[model samples]
Target: MSSQAEHPKTSSSPVQNSIPASSCPQKRTFSACDLNCKTIENKIRKKIKHSWKRILKVCKEKDISNVGEIPVSDFLDIAGKFNLDLSEGESNQITAKYDSKKNGTFAYYDFLQSCVLFLKPKETSLMKRVIIQKPQKPLSPGPQTTSFFSATLRIQPKILHCWRPMERTFKSHDETRSGLLNVSDFKQVLHDYNIDLAEEDLFNILEYYDKNLTSKISYYDFLQAFIQ
Candidate 1:
């Protein structure tokens, strides 16, 4: 992992139901929002990393019913300790956006998102510039080798688990429904879904699927690259 204290590199995602579109920065302000997203995400990650153990302890002390999750009240208390200005309205919004289980509590990553909601931006319109095209070439199944078999066995289940969600997630973010995600859109999708990945990681993975160097990746190639 990179130094938590250093600059972060995640992208932005869609506005959740609780946050109105008007609350998101308009397209005119996207460039600045883009830069802020990286810096803010980095800071949030660093703070969370430093205070995670403490947060967990707080959860236990508060007697949260679900381990690794904390209610809004406890979250606000800990957020205050971290010097975050969490308001009741914002806390409710965060819970609505990230409490995936509808449990009125937040998992660690989701909590991180809530803490940095100001950094989340509207989906950048830049992705619209890249035209969606079919995959120029199919991914190779790989050479038949003993190591391949072992690796496949080890990773197959994990891939299956992520595949369906990955597809669904990609579609959700691809508002154009164009069966592809440009680089910006893909990064934003990763950010929206709270996938822990670096900018370099996204680029390298995209390289495998972006055969034409078009900066666009199709659904088939997305599945291939995402699973890796």
Candidate 2:
């Protein structure tokens, strides 16, 4: 049998052993496109912060539990309530951006934080000092020692002359025709009618009228109390 001559196994060539520069993964560099995207994102955030209070109020009205989230439909309704004027596509984009859980609900607190810079407790020492210097009285009345009707008597004369017009104004603000107005709207009606009362007294009236803590007072029932 003829023995064939065996050659030593050749080692991998440099071209084969070394990875090509093109084939190796490269570190991503921040480009102008990325900068433009960041600019647009910041603009959206600024706009959101500008309307933060109204958005929060509407969200609170709908999310009574204060879970910091609401159904997508309610979230959209909030836009209409505050006249955000979001187009269908814009609304969809917002929902997608804030619905982090993918559960069909928008997390409002997440959205709020993305735009609004809330002061931390440690950062609000100045505000705390101001509050401490002049403590605010609770808006809700404590112990029902006095009758509500008696309380109304104080503001009666002021509202008495313009009572009918005041009723009309209150009804007009009842945009939902629910015959009820939220606390802010009720206060606004009183302001428009030029019926002023001390803050404590105004809150006392609200507490009496909003006994259920529903944040809504029936205008008809409320106005009748003033007359009586």
Candidate 3:
């Protein structure tokens, strides 16, 4: 009986060894997967860093109160900056989801989250190498363009939180009633808004809107470059 029992146990050794050999590949696969995960995580972190820089730059340029936080009212500005064609309701929902503090502002990390909210790990790799587009020449106002920018206040009041204020601000600076602002006037208004930018940066902002290089910007110009 003892000899028979020993013989049966001996036969199981080869099978047990084969099981461990098969598991070696499974372990290697998990190891490779872990490396891939780390690579993607690193890419995400890099994108976050770049986004943070952009957020700060925009906040400084716009003179937003909280340096690292973005107000819900500025969602349009963010959307425009990032080329996100989000609707008013979509902007509101995104803000509500990430703005956990409910302080009318999204924290820095929250802003980053908003920027990449819809992207998965694979998608982030594409985002990491995205190139900034050059500002396009301002198209002449047509019916379609007019409808696109037509005072969205009544239709989507929440999204255009800064619309009225921008109107008032623009009017106050547009002393000639030309519905336009020259470089000096533009600089002064930005100053009034507390945007303390260097001379070169200010010129660059003006150039972006002054596509004709006319050294002046119209109300529509301002709306297109900053408000839309």
TM-score for each model: 0.29, 0.35, 0.31
Please report the candidate that would top lDDT against the real structure: 2
Best by TM-score: 2
C-alpha RMSD values across all candidates: 16.9, 30.2, 28.5
Candidate 3 per-residue lDDT over residues 23-49, each given as its tens digit: 111233645644443344344444543
Q: lDDT of model 1 at residue 166?
A: 62
Candidate 1 deviant stretches above 4 angstroms? 1-43, 87-90, 109-228
Q: Model-by-model lDDT, in order?
A: 0.46, 0.53, 0.41
Q: Which should have the higher TM-score, number 1 or number 3?
A: 3
User: Lowest summed lDDT over 10 consecutive residues: which window, candidate 1?
Assistant: 14-23
lDDT by residue for model 2 over 1-228, one digit each (tens)? 111212112243111111111111124233543343334446566456457667776876888765567888998887787666677756665676656566777776555543443211122443333212111211232222122223454465566578777877876776666666677777778888776655556555655556556666666655443332
Q: Which stretches of model 3 miss by more than 4 angstroms?
A: 1-163
TM-score (C-alpha, index-matched) for candidate 1: 0.29
Clash count, predicted structure 3: 0
